[model samples]
Target: MTATPDIVPPTEVRMAEIVFPNHTNHMGTLFGGQALAWMDKAAFLAAARYSRRAVVTARSDQVDFKLPISVGQMVETVGRIVEVGRSSMKVEVELIAEDLHTGERKLCTRGHFVMIALDENHHPTAVPALPADIAGP
Candidate 1:
C-alpha cells in the first residue's frame, strides 16, 4: 500500500486592532462586548481557514477578562484550532494589549469558541480531521 501524505495543520490566525475612544467605555478601557466581538471574529477566521468553508459560531465558553486595555493601545487577537469533531472545531483565542510608546504587552482576555462548518445549503458539514501528529493522544 502507498503511504498517505502528511496533513499539515492550519496556520494560526492573528488580527490586530487599535483601541480608539469609540471602542472604549467611560472608564477609558476596552469594552467587554467589543473584546468578545473581536475574539469571535478571530475564531471565525481561523475555522474558515482550516475548513475552507463557511463557518458560524456555535458557542463561546470560558471567557475571562484578565486586564484592562486602555485607549491608544494596540490589541492583537490570535486564534488557533484546539480540537476537531465531525463538523465542529474548538478555537482558542487570546487578546493581547500593547502600549505603543512603552512596548509593554499583556494578555487582556482569553476564550474558547466552537465553530461549525457549513455546506452550500448552510447546513452543517464534515470537516477534515486533525493530523495524527497534531492531534496528540
Candidate 2:
C-alpha cells in the first residue's frame, strides 16, 4: 500500500474578521460554505505573498469543522505551503473563531488546498523558491 505523505507546517499565518450577518444559519454561527470560501481566499493570499505571482485554487481537501463561529467573532485563518512542485503548491489551512466579547477562540476547521500559479497567458507558471524561512520545515 502506498503511504500517505505527512502534511507540512505552515510558513505563515493570515487572519481576518468574521463580521456580523456573515453568520447565515440564524444559529449565531457562520455558514460552513462561507468559512470554506474565505479559507480558500486566505490560502491564495498567503501563497501569492510568498510566490509573488497570481495563483489559483486547483483543489480543496475535505474540510472538517470542529466548532461553530458566531457573529462578533474574530476569525483567524492560517495557511502554509505543505508541498511544492514545478507549478503547484499544496497549502494547509486552519480556521479559528474567536468570541470578541469573551475572548474565547475555537478551532473551526482544518483542510488543505492546492493552488497553481499562472502566467499572464493564464498558463501554469513556476513559483519562486519559498522564502528561506518559508522553505521545507
Candidate 3:
C-alpha cells in the first residue's frame, strides 16, 4: 500500500497582524471580539491547508485570554490541525503578542475552532484523512 501523508503543526499555518488603536478597547487592550475573529481566520487557513479545500467555521471551543495585547504590539497567530474527522477539522490557534520595539513575546490568547470542508455546491464534504504518523502537539 502507498504511504500516507503526514502533517505538522508548526508549519501548518502562520498569520500575523499589527495591533492598532482601532483594534483595542477603551482600556488600550486588544478587544476580545477582534482576537476571536483573528483566531477564526487562522483556524480557517489551517483547515484549508490540511484539507486542501474550502472550509467554514463550524464551532469554536473554549477561548481564554491569558494576557492583554496592547496597541502597537505585533499579534502573531499560529494554527494547526489537532484533530481530523470525516468532514470536520479541529484546529488550535494561539496568539502571541510581541513588543514591537523589544521583540518580547507572550501568549495572549488561545482557542480551538472547528471547520467543515465545503464542496463546490456549498455543501459539507469529506476531507482528507490525517496520516497515521505525524508530528505536533
Highest TM-score model number = 1
The segments of candidate 2 whose C-alpha lies over 4 angstroms from its true place after superposition are 1-13, 131-137
What are the per-residue Cα lDDT tens digits for candidate 1 across 53-125? 9999999999999999999999999999988999999999999999999899999899999999999999999
Which lDDT tens digits does candidate 2 get at residues 16-97?
A: 8765785557786888878888889888987777667899999998889888777778889988787788888888899988
lDDT of 2 at 110: 95
Pairs in clash, predicted candidate 3 = none
Residue 74, candidate 3: Cα error in Å is 0.3
Can you give the TM-score per candidate against the true fold?
0.92, 0.81, 0.88
Ten contiguous residues with the weakest lDDT in model 1: 128-137
lDDT score for candidate 3 against the true structure: 0.88
**lDDT winner, 1 or 3:** 1
Top candidate on lDDT is 1
State the lDDT of candidate 3 residue by residue for 1-137, as single tens digits: 99978544332688889999999999999999999999999999989888888999999999999999999999999998878888999898999999989999999899999999999998989987665565344
Which residue pairs in candidate 2 collide? Answer: 10-80
Q: Hey, what RMSD does candidate 2 come out at?
A: 9.1
Order the candidate numbers by lDDT, best to worst: 1, 3, 2
Worst 10 residues of 2 by lDDT: 6-15
